[model samples]
Target: MSLRAVSMGAAYHTAGRVPGPFYRLAPVVAWTVWNLNPAWRRRLTRTMLPLCEGDRARARRAARRALQHVLEYYLDLVTLPRRDMSRFERDHLEIFHNERLDLLRSNGPVLLVSAHTGNAEMAIQALTFRGRSFVALVERLEPRDWAEYMLRLRSSAGGTFLEANFAGVRSCIEALRRGGVVGVMGDRDIQHTGVCTSFFGRRVRLPRGPWELARRTGATVIPIFSSRKRGDQFRVYVEEPFVVEESEDAERDIRAAVERYVVLLERHLRRDPGQWAVLEDFWKVHACGEG
Candidate 1:
């Protein structure tokens, strides 16, 4: 059997046996990925030292432990078990799905801005299962097989997948024009053309895509994040639309929107630090000066 199939089968089996297998699956996956993914391993060493302080060598060791926690969470998400939630997940899903369904029913393009918070992948299922044209801008997949597997998993939403690039931006706009919802992560930096802003009392760059898309397409920018509740349950928080003013100076407008987004994101992260899994050097504000 294929690796993806094996993983899927194991996930289902675990789900049937336990209340939540994601918690268990996450650590194992992270450890495996850490061992296999040399790129991430190097990044972990470089990015983590600032967050942990001790002897330089010891700091790198400590950082690995911290990265493990965050990586494990990522693993849990990639291998999330069947959403056939027990009593706990069911009740919360009802409230969240119902409200989102209502919003989707309305005749307007929506920009669903999400973050890397608790079980966010599940949010796609909750929003799209009932029939809504939703597309997400996904980062380029590495390790061809894993990429293919992610594409299939994401296809559960029944939405088109677009690469995170200019072409993808065009496709997203077109999708929005057709009255579809386009979901994008606004909290993390895209590293290209991102506007620097303050987050968690430090300067960090955020993707300009969502804000620009909203301004160009006139789509309602709605903040949506699904957080794990007590057991299998999750709370999908959907805030009201943010009204962004357009300006002749496009840069100014985008920056203004980014600043507002930073505020909203900061509030959420502070309220639930665990839910916000930003383990990288997110606050490395200034560009390193020339030697």
Candidate 2:
């Protein structure tokens, strides 16, 4: 087993045996570290400054809270399997615009596009509780064991996982053709072949795969967002789905479709600026160095 697997295994077993109050301390420690760590502070400030409307102080505060929330999110994941499902539903999860989900259920196929903000993993997991199953495309993390461990956590609620790769893309397309739902991240360009678009009054490149896939498969593109309300409680937003408009210029059409999501993503980020968890220099032209 890898080091990460070992650590996660230890945490899982410990959290399972210990009381819930003890698990709560993990976020406290994470928050302190997030504030003290220089590298994390710099990255957070750089990514959040503009998002906070150029307010340096507000950006710094949001950065600290963003890290704290992200850490809390992961801690919740490790202990999720041990929590009571009924209690979780009654006390933790809240769904807004659920009729949109009903629409998705009645529709054929869908491409669920979400950002790095909030507990996105949990959003996908929420579908399982509602008796909906979907395939999520995720980037493989470092240390094979850690990746496997995360994949296990993500699928524990009943969804499927597909690594972000060529084969995974093919599998996603096939699944969509068969009227299956596929969840993908829309905020960052993992493959570096993204299309440039305006976000928060700045230019950033977003992944084109989701839009391209939607166009090819005639899938409805829906924007989903998850926000941590307090402690382990969360609010999930499922927006209406829109079909990508096709035009003679395929590339332009794809860029336009991506721009639409960019607008939606920016709106969500503005609403909950602290929950936006992207750590990269998203607006920098050469951030990816993928020439």
Candidate 3:
């Protein structure tokens, strides 16, 4: 069991933002098999939420069903050919297809804050199909082969990948000023100076880059996501722009803004825990005083 678990972990960790659809689809295929089988799904469900109340077996069953529903859509993403993805866009138009229409249709820059809850790749694809102006911030992939492949894939989605570093910020700011949107995910703390906030009822580090950039640029802060829905479709949720509240204590005010973002992230994750793909001790470093 330990070997099998470690092997899966290694595989996922090594596949950092692989751009090709095949590379991304491989794991989804494995996950779908794991999810389709009732017994296996129930076992994983129980292991994931052992702390939940009620009869362990019954609780696991309900959670298993919910996960199955989520996985069904993930499977569709892999199995179905997305040819003329334009058609799929129209079918789900109600799901925020028009929320950023003006910004995308125009030449001005915008900031999009996303989290790691569902298949974010689909959201990026949707933006590209609609001629959205945006660049996505992500950690640079190591190894020459991997980096080259990922950049190609990301470019197909209309995103210019800015490596996570000081220089990347300059590029991101440029994109915003050029009437393009900059996309960043805030759920995980990749920066040493990230603001600490509560998540899942416990304090953890949250990235402050988006809020800081928004304040500096006077650009809109939009929270956008594409979560899996029934029947292999996606529900694109777009919250109104977030304004950074000013205060005498700027540092404290920044932390406060981050806390609010964390709260919304927690609520969304709680609504669909299976959508979260985290497997490590997410709060471990914080709890140990290392963060």
Candidate 4:
């Protein structure tokens, strides 16, 4: 058995057994320990420097908050399977501009590009509470059992979960072909293969799956995001939705759509960098080359 599997399983069970106050304070402790790690501090500071507008102290503060929120995200994710969907949605989740979600129910195929920011799972669960069912393309965690645990928990709310892979790509295309709603994480290039584009004024690679699926199926691509206001309070942002024009130049259309998605993501990050839950050094390659 992998160490990650043991740790994840233990955490899930322990988190469920702990008292509410200690469960709530777990993030503070987690982030405090995270900040004590020199490598983690560097990663957080590097990420926050630009997002915090170059204020070192402010960036550090934001970075700390961001780390805390990240731990909260994992905690919520693990314990979600035990939550009462209706009570959770009523007491914790708040959707801003929710009317925008109507696109998911329309006759046409819908593609939502999301980020690691905030509790995206919370947004997904809330949508399920409203009787909305969609396919969420999630990264497959290592140690197969861990991935299975994630899929089971996420799909417990009636939403579909597909691993981001070649087979998953086929499934996504099929879903869109049936005019289904599909969501993909737009910020991270998990597969390493991506479309190079400008984000935060620096060149970065973003996943090509969403744009490709949209182009092939003529699906409407919407740039949506979620942010943790505090505790269980979350905001799901639905911005401009557009279709990729199938012009003579396929690559151009995809790249242009990517640029638009990048703009929306940058706008969200600027509002509060701490909402971004990805703790890894995201920009492993930046400003390397033009698309």
Candidate 5:
């Protein structure tokens, strides 16, 4: 195994074996290191300022909180395998608009679209615990071994994991066609060939795969949001499902669907800007060329 993978594996094993309270210190250390790193601090500040409307102080505070939440999220991941389901449900997981989920459950297939906010991995696990079958579309990590490790974790959550590739795309379609749920992160476009849409009054490219899949399979697209409420606690919000409009022009339909997702994403971001953990220069990336 690669050195990074080996190290990660050891860390995960250690974290799992250790008691939960011992792992709580991890977020403090990680948050301190995050603040000490100039590059990371700059990235966080740059990403947060626009979201905070140019308030430097508010941006800095939000950035610090975001990093702390990220560390807590990672700590939860390591300890997740050993967590007791009853305790997990009672202490950590909170669901809102659950009736909406029930409504979708009775329908055909569902496309659960969410972003990189809160403990998203945990959110998926919570859904699986509720007896929802999911095929999660994931981006491969840098080291192959690390990707495999994450794949194992995701699979352990009682969901099928598919990398974001052509083969994965085929599997997603098959899963949806079989009346299964397919979860996708729709905020960022790793595949550069995404459809351009307006977000926070700025043009951004969001992954069009979810929209395309919904259109092709006639699946209902539901935007889900997960946000941290407190230490190791999260609230998951399930929005009403909507069908992507079908038209003669495929491209236009995809664009419309992507824009709709962006609108939902913006609404959630407005509610908790700090929870939107985007560390890149999102606003400036494709501002000039697309849309």
Candidate 6:
């Protein structure tokens, strides 16, 4: 069947034990899904429409590649448990502007703000290889077993996860206070706790957790992203990091962080819209304010 047709739970629980098939057949399944999944095509194409300057044809092509990238990420993700992480880091993952990660030691409890465009997990793995443990803030995926499996793979590299909950928030705060790295995705607002912001010149609500956490903890907020350069070769880009000033105007501070993040997000998405692996319609479906 198609790649998207299989649930993560079933995939991991069954064929995941033997990832040889997953490794070889992933591209074929991704291609099949991209060609046959009309709903998926429509969703990704619409998400890329505004970005492509009205070229629906180009948007379609980008949509296909975007889906392929997402599938490749899943293939690597589901099968990563069996690989040599050290070799994976050495051969597959590379970080750009790596010196910026030094902020973790200089003035730390670094908060990495990333989007869905790239495989942020690769970035996490790269950090883990460098001996920096992280407290990654993650949204719970569906099918409890699948989520647990993912969390396990995530923790395999000497890091921990902060689930999207009050307890998780507390843990994240504690970790930051202890001068640890905490990663958060600043793109989707699954919690509905986000402040309205602009993205791709359209109004959307990105997660407030990253910026608010930084404001509260005074953590260094670094905008990072990752992309598969070829196949499994991932390049993690570390953008300029900043701190959200805890001023008397708290709302302004958070909003400013949101605005700055979106500007960079838009810039990266523009570079190669196909790297945006989000399958949902980002503008209307996920937006808080009308565009």
Q: What's the lDDT for candidate 1?
A: 0.64
Model 4 lDDT tens row, 179-253:
887888888888877888877766778977788889999999877788987666778887877898899998898
Give one digit per residue, the lDDT tens place, for model 2 in 1-291.
Answer: 888788778877876456366446756876779767889888888888878899999998888878777766667767767665435555667878878877456547888889887687766665656555688898878898799888887666667887899988999999899988889998888878888766776666789999999999998888888888866778888877898878888899899888888777778887878888666655664243333
Query: What's model 3's overall lDDT?
Result: 0.60
Q: Return the clash pairs for model 1, or none.
A: none
- Give the C-alpha lDDT of model 2: 0.78
lDDT digits (tens) for residues 1-291 of candidate 6: 333335655665655467666656756787899888889888889999877876899999888888888877776666556667666666777878988877765646788889886688766766666656788878877666666767776676567875788898889999889888888888889788888876776777787888889999888888998877766678888899898989899999999999999888888888888888888888876677655
Pairs that clash in candidate 2:
none
Q: Cα deviation of 117 in candidate 4 (Å)?
A: 0.8
Whichever of 2 and 6 has more lDDT, that candidate is 6
Q: What is the C-alpha lDDT of each candidate?
A: 0.64, 0.78, 0.60, 0.78, 0.78, 0.78
TM-score of 3: 0.70
Q: For every model shown, what is its TM-score relative to the native structure?
A: 0.72, 0.90, 0.70, 0.91, 0.91, 0.89
Q: Candidate 6: where are CA atoms >4 Å away? A: 1-25
Which ten contiguous residues of candidate 2 have the minimum total lDDT?
282-291
**Per-residue lDDT for 1-291 in model 3, tens only?**
354344333443443223245344644564676667766565555534622333466445445544554444333333323234456566643465455545656565577788765656556556666777567777665564555544554554345776778888888887777667788887767766787765655556778888887766766777776566544456777766666766577787678768778766766665666565443345554432432
Indicate the residue-level lDDT of 281 in model 4. Answer: 76
C-alpha-based local distance difference test score of model 6: 0.78
- For model 3, the run of ten residues with the poorest summed lDDT: 74-83
Residue 114 lDDT in model 4? 87
List, residue by residue over 171-270, the lDDT tens digit for candidate 1.
9999888888898988776646688666544455678889889888888788877665534456777766775668789899899988887777666654
Cα lDDT for residue 249, candidate 1: 92
